[model samples]
Structure formats: C-alpha cells, structure tokens
Target chain A: MIRFFTNVWNNFKEYIVLVILILASLIILSQNKSPQVQKVRAIAFGSFATFTSIISDMFSVTDLKRENQQLRERNAELMIQISKLRKYGIINEELKDLLGFKDTANVPLIPATIISRSLSMTQNMLTLNAGRKHGVLPGMPVVNDRGFIGIVHSVSEDFSIARTLNNVDLKLTVMDERSRINGIMKWTGEELVIINIPNTFDIKIGDRIVTSGISSIVPLPLPVGIVEEFRPSETSGFSYIKVKPFVDLKPIENVFIIAEVQSKQKKDLELNFYRRQSDEIR
Target chain B: MKFDKIFPFLIFFVGLLVQVTIIPLVSINGIVPDLILIMLVYYSITRGQLYGTVLGAYYGLSVDLITGSLLGSAMLSKTLAGFIAGYFSTETKRDINISTFNFSMIVFLCSMIDTLIFSFFSAFDFNTNFVTVLFEHALLPSLYTGVVSILFIFSPFRRKRLL
Candidate 1:
C-alpha cells in the first residue's frame, strides 16, 4: 500500500503540469473560438428545447381564456394596419417588391416556449420548453420577433437552459449594421451593459447590431439589438456601450429556434475540423 | 451519522427552495438569503468542526448543481466558511444565551467570508467594489438569515440532545 501511494505521488507532479499546459494552450487557441463548437453546441441546445416542449405539454398554468383574448386583439390590430396600408397603396408596392427579393424556404423554424427565468439582480438565465426530440440542440440561436436573444448552452431530455444577452457569459461576434465596424458583445454583471469597443470603431447609439458571421455559430446579418449607450474608455482604444435588447426577456413568451441551413460543403467543413480537433486532444 | 443521513438531505431541499424562490421574492436587491450557511452555522455551534466542514461541502455542491455555475466554486467557499465557524464554536461562551444579537454577529461574519470567497473565484480579482458586494450580498443576507435563526434556534429540533 505504501509503495502504491509513493509511486502515484511520484508521477503526480509531471501529470499535473502537463494537464495545466494543455488547458492553457486550449484556452489561448479557442479564445478566437472555432465555429464548429458553436454548431455542435446549437444541436445540443435544440435537443434541450425539444425536451422542454415535451414536459410543458404535460402541464400548463396559463389562463387560456386571457391568452385567446390577447391573440384575437393582436390579430385585429394587425388586420386594421394591413387594410390601412393597402388603402395608402405604398404598403402593397413595398411588400410586393420584398416578396420578389429573396427566397426564405430553406431555413425552417422550430417553435419553443420560455419555461423559467433567472431574475437575480446580478445575473440572468432562461430555461426553454424544448429539447433533443424536437431537433433543438446546443448552440442553436434563440430569437423572437424583435431580435436575437442568445445561444443555447445545455440540453436535457425534456428541457434546455440558455443564457441571454443579459448573462455575463454570453458573448456574440457582432458588428454595426450601418458602419460595418466589428466588435464583440458581452454583459458586465453590474447592469444590463455591453462594453468593449475601441474608440476608433465607428459605432453610434441607435446603430443596428447584427451577427458578423465571423462566428460559424451565429448566422450572419441577423438582428441582435440597438446600441443604447456609449462612453469613452479611460484608455484610448476602446469605448464601452450598453445595448437595449430587442426582446423583453422579462416577459419572453414565444421564441423561434432556427435550424441553420448549412450547405453540404459547409457541414463537411465543420465536421472535418471537429474530428481533427478531437483526435488531437485525445 | 443517522441524523446526518436524513437531516442534511431535508435541509438541502428546503434550503434550495427557499434560496431560489422565497428569498428572491423578499430580497432588498434580489439578494436571496443563504439557507445553507444558516444551517451549517447551527450545526457548527452544536456539533463541532468536523461536522461543520462536511455540511459546508454538501451545501456548496447543492448550490452549484442548481445554479449551474462552474462546479466546485460554491463547495470551496462553503467548506472554508464552515471550518472558520467551527473554530468560533469552540470558544463561544456556554452560558451566554443565544440571542438575536449573537445570531446576527455569527451570520454576518460567516456570510461575509462566504461572499468574499465566491466573488474572488468568479472574478479574477478582488479590486472592484468589495464594499458594495459585501454590503448588498453578504451583509443583507446575513441579517435576514440571523432573523430566521432566532425562530429556528428555539424550535423542537433543538430540544433533542445534539449527540
């Protein structure tokens, strides 16, 4: 017994240093982030959403009568607006031109519902009613009519957890839709703030935020939010900013889970990289 | 040990529900009371250092599982706090009645240490706004837990001999 313990201890220091070195290297290399990880994560998130949807099916506490009434009111308002737009003639012309512009048949949406919310003053997270069986996976982008919320992280058979833009851990590769200036989006725990841009960047309040496509996980040109606040950093290079997320996470009702319509070539490209990385790690 | 088998598990569920649900509703700034620390302190005062250290680890693990932060973060902090509280238990005056004031002081000290350790791990540095975190998260929750201990300390659970 003494000999066994001594032998293990003798080997422990060498193994510990090797493990630490490997971890440090991975951190440095992966900080730029490999898009393949994002895609796999999204798939895992999709699975979680599918599971949550199943569980929610078993029980619901919402007042159906009130929900039906609200839906009817919204539909009536939309109909009235549509009629008004037609009377003006410009709405038809604009919509007709838009319909002629591009094909949207390729990308399909899986519907998911919000199950729970993390509302601590300092931190926030969301659980969705969906998961694996419904094709929800980790790294899948969650959004509502307003804009992008955040990516799916973990998935269980019946439910999945997500971190929103409000979460400090959430980081998205984003750019100014107008100026095309690229930067990363992050949340600082103190407030609903997203900081870290160099002063040289051409960013302005009300400038539309969109996914930069630099990250394979995030689809390009998807609306994120509007820049709400900006201030110069004490050091010369960066400007800190706050964004008003388009979706009101406090009252998230319905969300759309997007299945990225990756071309066969792109799918192979990512899978190849992942396979290589896994092999190297092992 | 039989008490350990049952009471800790019971405390975990009750503490977690109160931690995630009830405490959040009543907090000054969404800062929930630390039920685990309160229970640990109670045990530490009566049980001893070894028991307190073990309970602290269990409490921390439960929080980590529920919150889904980095694993072991809470466990590390909780264990340290439990060990420190154990040292105090040895010196506490046996005749001094456990009063609201006494409970307040014990909880305030233990939770302050808990908050400082948690913050240190989550952030790489202790340089930013220690006063705010210590006051808001640590001090407020400690006071709230202290008030709860006043009621719990006299309950039937305490009537049974700790041994």
Candidate 2:
C-alpha cells in the first residue's frame, strides 16, 4: 500500500494538481454571474483591452486612410439624412403645437470605440471603451455608423462589455419595417432569428428589421437587420425568419454607444420587465 | 528552477499576448488558434508534467482574466491540456524539438482537448447543435494550432534557442 501510494504521487502529481485546480475553477465558474465577479472581470478586462488596443492601434494605422475615406462618405450621407429629418421634425412640431401634443424627450449620444471582442462561440460580446465614467451603464444600446449593435451587458469605471446583436443569449423586441409586424429576436446558431412571427404576416425578403422600442433601453425604430429567409417553425403557427445584421462585426472598429435612453419613470418599468425575464431564465 | 528558465516562460507569455490581440483579427469563424495551448504542449514535452500544469494554470488564468470568459473555463481547460500533454513528455530534455510529426500530434491532441473542455463549459447551449461547435470550433482550432506550431518551430527564436 505504501509503495502504491508513493508511485501514484510520483507518477500522477500533475493530475492531482489538475484536479485541485479544476475544483478551484468550478468555484469561480459558480460565482461567474455574481456582480462582484462581474465587476472584477470588468476592471481586469477593461485594462487588458486598453493595453491591447494600444498595440492594435499601431497595426491599424496603415489602414487609416481607407477607413477614413469610408467614414467620410458615410458621414456625408448621414448629414444629408439628418437635414431631411430636421425639416420633417420642424413641420411635425408645428402641427403638434397646434394640437397641444407634448414634446418627445431626446437623449444624447455617447460615442465609443470597439476595443476587442469575446472569442467565445456562444457568447458574442464586444469590449468598448465607454463605461460608467462616461455614463455608460448596463442595458445601454450600442450602435455603429451602419446600425444597431447590441446593449451594454456590464460596465466598469472606464470600460463596458456590449452583448452583440448576433449573440444567442440576447432576446429583443424587433419589428419588420414594411409590414410593421413585431417579433422576438434571437440567435439561431446558423443565423439571427426573429421568432414567433405568424405565417399570416406580409413579410418579405430584404425587409428591414428594427427595434420595436417597447423597452426603454432601446430607442424606437433603431435599425437592426434585414430579413434574409423564412421557414415554418416547429411551433406550427409561426414563421422562423432569418435576419442578416447590418453590422457584420468583422473589421468593425469605430462604433457609438447610443446612450440615448428614456425618462426614469419609463425606464424603470422596462427594467422590471427585463429583470423578471432574466429571473425566469434562471 | 533556474532563473534563465523564466526567460523561456516569458517567450511563452508572448503567445498569450498574441492570442488575445492578433489572433482575433484573423479568426476563422470565431475560432482563433490557441497559441497558449500550443505553448503549454511545447513546454510539457520539453520540460515535465508538474512544471507544465502549474504554468498552464497561470496562462489559463491570464486568458480568463483578459477575455472575461466564464471566469474559470480557460483555467480548467488549460490545466487539463497541460496534464494531458505531459503524457507525451520525453525523459530527456536535450532531444526536444518541434520539427517532427510526433510534436505536431501532441500539440494537435492537446489543443483539441483544450478547446473541447473550454467550449463545453463556456459555450454549450441547448439551442446550437453541439456537433457544429465540435467541428467548427474544437476540431478546426486544434488543426490550426498544430499548423501554427509547426510554423513557429522554424522561426528564428526557436532556431536560435531563445524560446
């Protein structure tokens, strides 16, 4: 027995260490969702992103000219659209004033950069430079020059993680632009899916999908994706639709955190809904 | 352990930095090469089992902290990979080299084990097909890591004995 024990210790010391370390890892995994560990991960990953961004910036300089040209073109297009929208808004306001309609609230945009991305297959998250210090909070919406990206999942003082739109874990209220039909959006592994759309809806390929804006964190009519294909779901009464996101996420560098949010009263109600939904998941 | 042994470990850490920074730019369908796994495999075959496991834990912890993964998934995956690689460890360190097919096989196997465990803990979902993840992520990444390891063997650092 003594010889057996000695031989095992000599031959399998690494496995013993592996077992002990795996146990420690399990403990950490169990607490992975806690706010305390989330904060720690935020701080540590924030610093790591900051450090790596410095290196990425060096390599990215060579592509600056091309990226700058593309941004300039996009900026011009957006500016023209903004001017058109302003004219429409002015006309609408004048009509609303005559009708005694209350003015709508508008929140400011907080611009940020995409620092890095999570390499996990199931968890599609992006690390952004904006954080609590920049008034970025969890559940804040993220967007790029193209369209809606995701919502802030967690935040540190100087950095926050955004759950990308392609992530399977995120369930959002999305609308079909043409038909104005709304559905729940989720990742279907092979593609982004808009779930539970009834077969009766007059939806089509190339129709724009945007945020239904039922939630406070998301502004209404935010562009998300375009419908790609549709198939009958297992649920029997619904159409399982695939959507191709406007933002591919690959080669994405410059993005904005649309810190635009609703009033506290409205936001609190939506937050309660989200909290309940999350609780039900667990 | 000799103080100079720490230098080679620093070289291994560069692999971690590469994994975090450069690999993402070239990721093939979100399956980035596991440079740290390859490093652990190399060191295990060159050194011994006990040394590899401890170093693997450290490297994996660094990855978990940097990537904000499910906290301990990488740590467990990497520690287990190191222990597995240690099985292929040579008795004598003098003959250790990465040129042979044997070295690549060890790296390939170790990397597959690393990815399998990592995706299992961090990415296993009821929605996505497990077979898809196993093919695109675990198997593909292991193959890519093995190819990259072979390339590194011919690099100047290894040739000059700096790694």
Give me the runs in candidate 1 sitting further than 4 Å from their true place: A1-60, A65-123, A144-146, A192-196, A220-224, A247-282, B91-99, B125-163
True contacts kept of 2: 0.62
Predicted model with the maximum DockQ: 2
Residue pairs with backbone overlap in model 2: none
lDDT (Cα, tens digit) per residue for candidate 1, span A1-282: 999878876766334433443344335334324455444444543443343444444445568734743564354334334433433353355786777834333345566676544423344566676666678777888766566777876666555666777665677788776777777776554544445577767888898777675666675356777888888787656787777766666545566666553345776898999999999999
| Model 2 error, position B54 (Å) | 2.7
TM-score of each: 0.67, 0.82
Candidate 1 total steric clashes: 37
User: What stretches of model 2 exceed 4 Å from their correct place?
Assistant: A1-8, A62-106, A198-202, A234-237, A261-263, A269-282, B2-13, B92-97, B160-163
CA lDDT of every candidate:
0.60, 0.74
